[model samples]
Every structure is written in C-alpha cells, then in structure tokens.
Target: MNPLHVDLGVTGSVLDVVRAPAGVLSTPSPPVDPTAPEVVQLAADLVATMRVSPGCVGLAAPQVGVAAQVFCVDVSAHPKTRTSHGTFVLCNAEVVEASRNERAREGCMSVPDLTGDVKRATRLVVRGRVPLTGAEVTVTTDAFEARALQHEIDHCAGLLFLDRVAGAHALHQRQTYL
Candidate 1:
C-alpha cells in the first residue's frame, strides 16, 4: 500500500513560505513524533502550501518558519515525473538508499528568484513515518519523484539547492515562475 495516501482528516491553512537567509531555513530541523497532533497539523499545512504554490512539487516545515522534520510532496502532475506516489507527508524522512547521480535544474519556493543546477540521485529509497499514523514506510522511486524527495529531505537538513550547486556558474536567474 502507498503510505503517501494517508489522510490527516483536517483542513489545512495555507501558510506563508519564508525566503532564504531565514534562520529556520538554514538550521536543521529536529525530528518530532509523527503521531503528534501538532506534527499532523504541520503536515497538513505543508500540503496546503505546496498545493497553492505554482510549480511546487514539495514543501518542508522550515519553508514555513517551522523547524521540524516534516514535509509534503506531490509530483504526479509534473511532466518530468516518472515514479510518483501521489501526495503524501513524511516526518523524519531519511534517504536509506540512493544511486545514479544526475544533475538537473531545481527551483524552490523559498528561493523564488533563483534556480540552480544541482546533482541529485535519480534513484532513491527513503524511510520515514507517516504523519497521522506514525507507520514507517519505505518509498522506492526514480526520476523526478526521486529528485523531489531528495530536495525536501535537504530542506529538513537545512540545505537548499543553492548549497548543492557546484559554483556560481551553476546558478541562474529566474525569468519567470514555473
């Protein structure tokens, strides 16, 4: 069964996304109880925020000024998506396995004006707990879904695509928001 399909059974408020240089964005988040009410609400809020943001495939707690290891992802609508699990939230997510390095362009809601070329694993296996039930799940995916997972995981670790870039040469100014 796809663990990403769990429902929080609550309406989520769309929270404002914080920009880069914010202390929360750079500071690593600590793990929280996946079954905690606050964590469940945070997970819902993340999904709500990501849904409202155009071109956003994922959103992490730090992006909304929360320093917790929680995030939501949905790459089903993306053209580049190859193996998606639909929409889901994960707490304390960690990459258990990763292979196939591939460099690709990445954008962030927190860094609205810039996009970076960052190398990420195209194949990955992640272990995390579902938000409401605290059920541990292992997601094995490839292509864009893999990239999205890694991106949000990085946010939980207080790192951005900018940090993964090789240099200034790998950065580009956004001409339009996608």
Candidate 2:
C-alpha cells in the first residue's frame, strides 16, 4: 500500500526544508514508543508518502516534523537506485558500518529543488528493525543507493543536506529526481 497519501506534512520545497525543527520526546526513555498506534500509523503514512512523491527514495519521520525514529525507503524502483533490492521499512535504524573513499550526489524530499555532491561511503551496512513486523533486517548498499539510505537516516536525526554542504555553491538544480 502507498503510505505517502496519509498527509505527513508539506512537500517541503527548498525553502521549507530547513525551516523544520526536530521534535523531542521529553521522556528519558526511548521516544519511538513502538507500541503506540500513532507510531504504527506514522510508519504506514510514511510508506504512502514515499510511494506518491516523485523521485523520493526515502523519508524520515523528523522530516515531516515527527520525532519518531521511523523512515521508509524504496530504491529498487528508482531509475537512479539500481543497487536496491526493493522497497524497505526501517525503524530505529543506525549505520553500523560504512565504507570509506566514496562520494556521490544526493537529494531529498524535504530539500527539493536542488541536489548536491556529498561525501559518503560507496557501500554501507545498515542495521534496523522493520516498523511493520519488528523484525531485524540488515541491508548492504553501494553507490547511489548507499547515499540515498544515508540521506534518509540523517533526517531521522534532524539533520538536513545543508548541514553537509561544503560550500555555498554546492547545491545544484535537478530537472527531475524521480
């Protein structure tokens, strides 16, 4: 099912992307609260959001103003993400290990209208639990797909591409990202 339709928030043009601030759960405990129905629904909504948005390879809850550590990604179908097996569900994901000596251009749903060359691992091994079944899944990604996954993971932590920019002119426009 497409989860993009659940109205997580704005499509977030270049202007609105950085305007968003990350949310805090206040409790010392894990904010994910995996058992909450809203958390479940947010995961569902993210899947739909990823499905409907053109060129969106991944999305994080914080990108939509939600503090939960939930995100959705579909790289198999994307023309640029040939290394992906298919769509994936990630919850409380973390980059376990990443290969060095790799760099690639990246984009984001939150930071639309521009792309930038970011230094990232050509390959990565990510560890996380599936939001739906709560099963652990380890995904190994390389090249563009790796960048895409890393990009979304960063969002879960409230970091934007601008934070990675090396220079003011690093941003470049993309006619189409889908």
| TM-score of every candidate relative to the true structure | 0.97, 0.77
Clashes of 1: 0
**lDDT string, candidate 2, 25-128, tens digits:** 12111337543567767776777677777667777777666666887777877666658646666777889989874656777766667778678887899987
lDDT of 1 by residue, 34-104 (tens): 99999999998899989999889999999999999999999999999888899999999999999999999
True-vs-predicted CA distance for residue 11, candidate 2, Å: 20
lDDT of each: 0.94, 0.66
Pairs clashing in candidate 2? 2-48, 3-47, 3-48, 3-49, 4-48, 4-49, 55-178
Best by lDDT: 1
Ten contiguous residues with the weakest lDDT in model 1: 1-10
